[model samples]
Target: MEMLIVVAIIAILIAIAIPTFASSLNKARIATDEANIRAGYADVMVNVLLDDNYDAENGNASTAGQTKYYLQKDGSVATTDTNAYKTQGKNDSATTEIAGQKVGAWAKDKKVTYQYDNTKNQAVISFE
Candidate 1:
């Protein structure tokens, strides 16, 4: 009887923990996404201040520097022309090379990117 009670208690605890763990994991994902976006935005704006490659009508920035401007990603998956980034809106403009990370795991088939808005002279985030 004592062993059975222990087993039952363990099972109950596991069941309760599973959902709570899942929810916590999701919350962590959201927090990570927010942090990545904020930091990435700052990175892009800093690049703009240091870069001299802006053109009035082109809406572009340089990619030839030591660091490629994919913003948050690094290593191999960084520069691929795959779903890591979505090309739409003014992002498809020939002059602009948008830089940002994939959106949070809560979202699929989407990415967050940064581009310098020449008219406004500010870095803007775009979701695509």
Candidate 2:
């Protein structure tokens, strides 16, 4: 009877732990996605500065872990993807179309903001 009780307890613990572990893994994925997108934004800025073409769009170099990137063009960004030259929406909005994409704003409602700071000559990707 004691052995059966131990087995039951162990089974219960495993069942509980598995979902929690899965949840944490998902959260980690979201964080990774956010970082990837920010990196993409930085890449675009570097390319723009180096090439002297602010009108061109650049994407993320990451081939895995959610394909998210900023699509910049004409000194403004829209995540539409309709034009292929420029994507429509903001950070969170833009990410929805991309697989495994998670925007701070979309995921946590008040976590993400993407901005272009012309004064600093930088594309500022920040989270709330």
How badly does each model clash, as a count of residue pairs? Answer: 0, 7
1-128, model 2: which lDDT tens digit per residue?
99999999999999999999977776676555555555556554554454433432443222211222234333333333332222222333544422223333444322332444444444455443
TM-score of each: 0.53, 0.45
* Model 1 C-alpha lDDT versus the unseen true structure: 0.51
Residue-wise C-alpha lDDT for candidate 1, range 1-128, written one tens digit per residue: 99999999999999999999977775665555555556666766666655676443555555413333443343112323353533211212233232443332225334666555655555565555
Highest-lDDT candidate: 1
lDDT of 2 at 126: 41
